[model samples]
Target chain A: MIDVIHPSLLLFLGAAIVPLLRGRAQQAWMLLLPAAIIAVVFSLPHGSSGAMNLFGMDLLILRIDALSMVFTSVFAIITFVGALYALHVKDTTQHVAALTYAGSALGVVLAGDLITLYVFWELMVFTSVWLIWCRRNPVSMAAGFRYLIVHALGGVILLAGIILHVMDTGSVAFTAIDPDSAGFYLILIGFMINAAVPPLHAWLTDAYPESTITGAIFLASLTTKTAVYTLIRGFPGTELLVVLGVIMALYGVVYAVLANDIRRLLAYHIISQVGYMVAGVGMGTIMALNGSASHAFTHILYKAVLFMGAGAVIHMTGKAKLTELGGIYRYMPITFLLYMVGGLSISAFPLFSGFVSKTMVVEAAALDGRAWVWLLLSLASAGTFLHTGLKLPWFTFFGQDSGLRPKEAPLNMLLAMGIAAFLCIFIGVFPGWLYAIMPAPVEYNAYSTGHVLWELQLLLFTGLGFFFLLKHVGGEAKISVDTDWLYRWLLPKFALGVQRVVDRVWDAVLGGLMRRLTWLVSSLTHHHGPQGILARTWPTGSMVLWVAVMLAASLLLYYL
Target chain B: MDLGRLLEYLVENARVLRWFAYVVMAGLVVADILIPSAYDRFPWESIGGFGAFYGFISCVLIIVISKALGYLLLYRGEDYYDD
Candidate 1:
């Protein structure tokens, strides 16, 4: 039998073309496509099967094993939720862009070789930026530009690494890359940028808040998490990641603590949560990698729910800043509850999805004999609750009444959040479905009595920590500093300096050229009679004599 | 404001107040006890290397203290960036 092509590709691609159709057809396709893709993603032969060679150098596409399957399944789920969430959106450009964007990420999951991976990788960057640009505002356009510059830098580094990898190895395998050369590190940096690794993470918080309401939700889901998948794939065993991961974790904690914007706070926690995953990847154990991969999988679910809730608030009241929003739960109770689940899940509260997945990464960190990383990871974990879990929902939904009476989110939006909320609880309650599909053996249980008890104790103590440090958490606004300032602010300033130097050189060159032209014209005018020989009126007598002399000379030469 | 009230406010609002300060002093005392000397002609790199976290925490605490000091001493208005 012909290999069952993953239905997601067909459905998304088909929906993409629907934008070209009539209005009724477009809306119909938008509704149908996500469901079709989700069904097809689950209906596949339930095992790894796809090609990995196209041009004799292995065009590696479609490897659907447990590791990738877990990610792909959640990706499909989010794409569905995101699509439903966008059902009321009239912007077909965004709809088409979102489809192609989601499809490219699926292609990445199925991609089994370096070439195919890069192809999907670049497209994910290319198509997703349109969602940002879809906001159709100058602010959004600028945000998209910055977002592209950073991701393009990542893409360039990634491409360079892949080229060197292919040249050195004579094969384009998409497997755990050894530290044979700096190529792996280049590849790691490339992936790390998208993973929101610090010194490179500002593009996320800076641009994500600027995306259109639904656009941010879609923007948040795919690109960074896909890079996380790549890191898990390529740099799993590398030890250096442990240090970088801890820095990222701490950076997220400190910044989230100081952030005043709600979306920015969530954005910071993205880095914080990914820290645990990167540390897990560094640990290199099967359990740890599985944890990282599984956490990456569950993270997208909860994060998308959080974004959806945030998007709903922004949609209803047109407010995203924490200072502008408060007491919205009075109107949007469903979204508020949805957001609470998301917050709890992300904080890793016991019986939520994060509790099951995040603990895996922390356990892996503790097991790796890195006490400092474990301590920081624990602090970051507590900080997650303080910033995102308590701070986000409390500020946006339940804080002092600002008396902004917006309506509840639309039905489609609620449907999306409801589905995501269900998954969050369902996964926490019954992780067997997720565990069975892990890339590694899944003997480590998330729900041991001791594990649950300690997690509660940890969270309870951290709750005390947050309330104790409430003054610190809610202190006067200061930009919690991080390494991203280097690129976002400092590098741009450096670029401005370089640009000034280049502009001076250009001006001097042009000045010289213009002066040289003036000099040449003046010299010609001085040498020639009346004016420059190049553009002058010759005397009639001289012209006639010259023509006559030329004729005479020609005749004389011919005679000779 | 009176001098005592000003000092109390500064101490209460100091970013690195108390906890990190105690840690820093404890660290210095530990170093003093361990080495028994103010300066070594050739100190082991391991000591400094191993002491990086304690030192980093100390520095971070100092910055925090500096911020509170800035508020106390250099309490600029909040509209600094506006103009």
Candidate 2:
């Protein structure tokens, strides 16, 4: 008996039905579906459900706990807002893809077994790629292909790890295990890929900015956070994540500093922000884990706001590069304001969402006596302000006038950004509300005078440096080469060269052989024809003469 | 209702804003020492404006170092991959 319906199933059904509807019905369906999913998520009680025997194995398809619930609730909320932001889109493919992509992420979070999680993990990849493809540009097409290939590789790695894990443990239940085995290491690598840790991160920065305006918002929020969720669930105490997470934290900021495109800059910052959560998970303390969870929840809301604001600018002006945009505040005042909220939240400004959540992670590091980790993370925070908090807005909105007079974003986009912006401030002011839902109890305080003053000094000094080097720090109209350079350029050219050589070899070998065979057949047929010497009536006469000659020779041999 | 005008007013007064920012920076530096800090793992946390100095130096170093690295190796034309 089905006691509780899966939240993801509701989204999947909604996605299926969306394509059949048209115009107003589709729009209403898009809005109402996420709302219904949210309602269902809230109504359902926490426990394991959807368990059954399949092929002599137990499959727990749905698992709800504090960890999964936080992700589900945030996923549902983002879908609703993303739907509202995308209501102006006329393409039904985008609507379906968005809903299904979000649904698959929910499925992943709720999955109680490794096999079930893998199914949803692959679905997340397949569905999310369409958001990039729906842009229907050469860049988007290539990026989407790259995005798909990378995620497919990640999925394979994860599947291999799961198989080995199930074999060794004799169970498929997803639980935390010591990272002392090949299976767990493979699993960690797989999750790290999705988390966009440093060398494996180029796909995210390459693909996200190229997605359709609204699609980028969904792309930013779901995939990496789900990986963080899985990591926390399965490998919380793995110390390697701490090292990689710190590298990612600093690495993302540096790349973002070099980025010229506003959306791409935000995309790089996603790596940096997720790095904080990863570092928290690596710390493996209850406080750090809770911090990672709360940070993910808050990051989703604020990052969505940032993307919405940037998407609004791109949508209205048809400009994305920072060089092409300047003095946009003259036209997009509300967007500028909303984008600032996101910036402050990400920069960990006092009275912002990031300030409330990010501090916990830093405090965890401090409490754990990992002074170097804490220091690096704090430095990365300053860099985050340097690029995302200051550089992005200063260049795009407040820099020299490019003399562009684009109008404000559409009302729906504004409403979406506004909702996200409100949450950034709300969560900042009322920490207990967000803290109450965390997996661990709230013992850390974000509002102590020491924490607030220290945070403010860090942010303000960063801002001070921004103005001092404003001329040099602004982005240029240049692209920063990343690891994607290997596949995007080197490999393709190498493959083409190999293909040319193969074609020549095939022509030489196969063509020459075919010609010889054809010639041989023609020559034989010509020689054996009725008009030819061998095919004439001399065949029977020759046979009798040959027989007589053979008999005479046999008689001579017998006489000898 | 014309938010553009208000924003323009704020933005055009760049000199005033700069001064205001300087004041805030100085005040935070002083407050850092005056306020009784709840937790201090590093000895530098007790120093006045140490955080401010750290933040400023870190931001500048990040930009400068990244910009240097970008120019030396990473920077490429917009179609660097396409070619």
Per-model lDDT? 0.75, 0.91
lDDT, candidate 1, A1-560, per-residue tens = 22887654685568658668666777678868877788878876655455545667856467777777777888888888898898888888888788888889888877878888888898889988988898898878977998898889989999999888888888787888879954777788888888888777888887887787887777788888888898888888778888888878877776665566677778888888888888888888887898888888788989989989988988999877776777666678788878889988987877899988888887776556666776577667766776677767767876667689898899999999999989999989998877888888776778864455445544554554444444444434444434545665577789999999999999999999999999987787887747645557768999899999999999999999
lDDT of 2 by residue, A1-560 (tens): 45898988888988999989999999999999999998999887988889988887788999999999999999989999999999999999999999999999999999999889999999999999999999999989999999999999999999999888888888888889656555998888889899999899999999999999999889999999999999999989778889988999999999998999889999999999999999999889999999999999999999999999999999988889888888889899999999999999999998899999999999999989998998899999999988878998988998888788988998999999999899999999999999999997989999998888888888888888888899998778899999898888888999999999999999999999999998997788788866656776766888999999999999999999
CA error at residue A285 for candidate 1, angstroms: 0.7
| Chain B TM (all candidates) | 0.31, 0.86
Using alpha carbons, what is the TM-score of model 2? 0.92
TM-score of each: 0.79, 0.92
- Model 2 stretches with alpha carbons more than 4 Å out: A500-560
Q: What interface RMSD do all candidates show, one decimal each? A: 15.0, 1.0
TM-score winner: 2
